[model samples]
Target: MSVWDSIVGQQAVVGQLQAIVSGDPKALAQSWLICGPPGSGRSNVARAFAAALESPDRGLSDEPTNITRQVLSGTHPDVTTLATNKVTIGIDDVRQLILTSEQMPSTAPWRIIIIEDVDRMLERTTNVLLKEIEEPSPHTIWLLCAPSAQDVLPTIRSRTRIVNLAVPSTKAVADYLMASVNPALPAERQFDRHVAVRAARLAEGHIGIAKLYASDTQVMSDRDELIVGLLGLRKASDAVLLADDLIDTAKSQAEADVNRQTAAAEADFRRINGLGEQDRIPPKLRGAYNAIAKKDEIKRRATRRSRDVLDRALNSAASIYRDIAVLQNNAEDAVGLINMENRTAIAELSARLSRQEVVDRLEAITVARKRLLGNGNPMLVFEALFCALIPGRL
Candidate 1:
C-alpha cells in the first residue's frame, strides 16, 4: 500500500501531501505545523511526508521503496526526528536542531526535520527555533506536530503552514487494525474482526490504544480490572486501598516499561561505543559513557515513566466519569461507553450518584489531570482524585 494509506480518515490530508510530493509547487511550504489530538497519527503522517519528499522516484508507489522504508524506520540520515522524553525540550535541544537544519541535504532533495512534540518546548526554547524555522535553507523542510496549533507559540505558529488531523472513526480504526494483521500468520493466530471492533470502541478512536487492546490480553484484562475496581469503591477504607492499588499498578507498569527501555538504551550505547565483551572503555571516553549510561538517559527515562504512567491511569479513571456522565444525562444513545462491558457496574453508579455529583467527579478528574500534567506528585494527585471519586463515603 502507499505510505499515506496507513493514515486513516485523512483523505484530504493525503491528497494535499500527495500533491506537494508530486511536484505541485503551489502546495509546497518550507515549514508545516501538523495538528492533531493524541493518537491521531500526526507523527505518522509527518514521517510519510518526509519519506515521500526523500523518495520522489517512488512516485506514490504501493510498495515502499528503500528510501521510504529508511525514513519510516528512522535510519535515513537526511531526515532528523527530534522527540523529547523529558518534561520539556530545552534550549540546547533547539540549538542542536537549528545547527542541523542549516546543513545541506546529504542524499535527498530535502533535509527534513520532524519535531514530534513541539508543544513541549518552553517559550525560550521555542524562541531559539523561531529564526531558523522562518528562514531555513532552500533544501531544508521543518515538520512540527502537536496536539493543536494552539499548543504552540504564536511566533512559531505564524511561520508555518498548518494541517489539522481528525480522529478516525471506530470503523476506520477497526478496519486498519485488521488490515495490519500479518498475512503470514495462521488462521488460528489471526485477530478476529469482532475483537477489532470491540477494541476500537473501547479505545474511543485512539488507534494505538485500540491495537493494544486488540492484541494484548493482559492489557484488556488490566483495563477491565481497573474499571471494575473504580466502580466498586463504596467505603472510605475501600477507597484508600483501591487508590493505593491503582498507584501500585501504575508503578509496576511504569517500572516494567522503564526496565525494557533501559535495557534497549544500554544495548544501543554498547553498539555505538563499539564495546566488546572484554574491551574496557578508554579513560577519556569513560566519563562520557557513564553520563550516557547513568545520568542523562536514566533521568530522562524516569521523567518519561512518571508522565506516561500517570497519564495512562488518569485516562482510565476519567473514562469512568465520562461513562457516568453519559448515563446520567440519558446520552447513551449519542455516545458509546468506553467500558461498555461493565455496563452493570456503571449503571449502579448512575443510580447511586446524581448528575451533579457525576459532573463534580469529572471536575475532580480534570483538575487532577491538569496537576499531574503540570508535574504534580502522582500519589498526591491520585489520593485527592480517589477520595473525590467516592465523595460522601470517603
Candidate 2:
C-alpha cells in the first residue's frame, strides 16, 4: 500500500505535502512543522512525508518503493529521527542532530531529520536548534512534530512552514479501526463494527487510544471501572480510596511500560555489541550500556509517564461530566455524548447534580491536569480532585 494510505483522516494535509514534493524545487522549504493533538498521527504523517520526499517518484506510485520502505522503517541512512521517550529532549541530542543535518544526502534527493515531541525541548535547547533551522543546508529538510505549534518557541515556529492537522471524525476513526482488523485472526478475536464504533466514540477522536480500546478488552474494562467508580463516589472516604487507587494504577502501568522499553533497549544494545543474552558485558561495553540505559533518566521518565497516565484518566473523567452536562442541558443532539454506553449512569448523575455542579467538576478536572503538569503531588492532586467531584459538594 502507499505510504499515504496509513495516514488516517488527513487528506488535505497529505495533499499539501504531496504538492510540495512534486511541485517546483524552489517552493520546498528546508524546515516544516507538523502540529496536531495526541493520537492525531503527527509522527506518522511526518514519516510519510519523509518517505515521499525520498522516493524516486516522490510517492506518486501506487506502491511504496524500497526507499519509501526504508524511510518508514527508520533504516534509511539519509533519514535521521529523534524520538525521545523521556519528558524532554536533551540539548546534547539536538546538538548531535544538528551536526548530522549539515551532511548531504548519501543517495536520496533530500536528507530528512524528523523530531517527534519537539514541544518537549526547553528554551535553551530550542535556541540551539533555531540556528540550524535558520540556515539549513540546501539538500537537508527538518520535520518537527508537536501537539501544537504554540508548544515551540516563536522563533522556531516562524522559521518553519507549519502544517496543522485536525482530529478525524468518530466515524472515520471507527471505519479505520474496523478495516485494520486482521482477517487472519478468528472471528471472536477480530473487532466487529459495533466494537469499533464504541471504541472510536470513547476515544474521542484519538486513533491510537481507539485502537487500544478495540484490541484490548482490559483497557475498555479499566476505563469502565474508572468511570463507574467516579460516578459512584458519594463521600470523602470513597474519594480518598479511589484517589489512592488511581495513583497506584498509574504508577504500576507506567513502570510496566518503562520496564518493557528498557528491556528492549538493553537487548538491542547487547545484540549490536555481539553479546549473547546470557553473556557478561565487558568493562568497556558496560559503560556504553550504562550511558544508553541511565538509571536516573529511567526513574524520571517513569514519574513523567505516570503523570501522563493520570492526565489521560483525568480527561476521561472530565468527559463523563461533559456528557452529564449535555444531558442536563438537553443538548444531547447538538453536543453529543462521549460516554454513551454509560447513558443510564450519566442520566442518573445528570438528574442528581445540577448543571453548575457538573461544570464545577469539569473545571476541577482541568485544574487537576494543570497541577499535575506543574509537578504537584499526584496523590494530593487526585485526592483534591476526587473530593471536588463529590455530587452537590461544590
Looking at candidate 2, the ten consecutive residues that score lowest on lDDT are 180-189
Mind sharing the TM-score for model 1?
0.86
Query: What tens-digit string does per-residue lDDT give for candidate 2 at 1-394?
Result: 8878878888899998888888888778989999999999999999999999899878778888999999999999999999986668999999999999989899988889999999999999999999889989888999999999999899999999999999988888888887765354467767788888998888888888888788767667878888988989999999999889888878877787788788989999999989999999999888878876688988887887787678779979989988887888789999699998789988998989877777788888889888887778889999999999988689
Candidate models: Cα lDDT each: 0.82, 0.88
Task: Give stretches of model 1 more than 4 Å off.
Answer: 181-190, 258-303, 391-394
Which 10 consecutive residues of model 1 have the lowest summed lDDT?
181-190
Residue 296, model 2, lDDT: 90
Clashing pairs in 1: none
Question: Once model 1 is optimally superposed onto the true structure by TM-score, how far is the C-alpha of residue 91 displaced, in angstroms?
Answer: 0.9
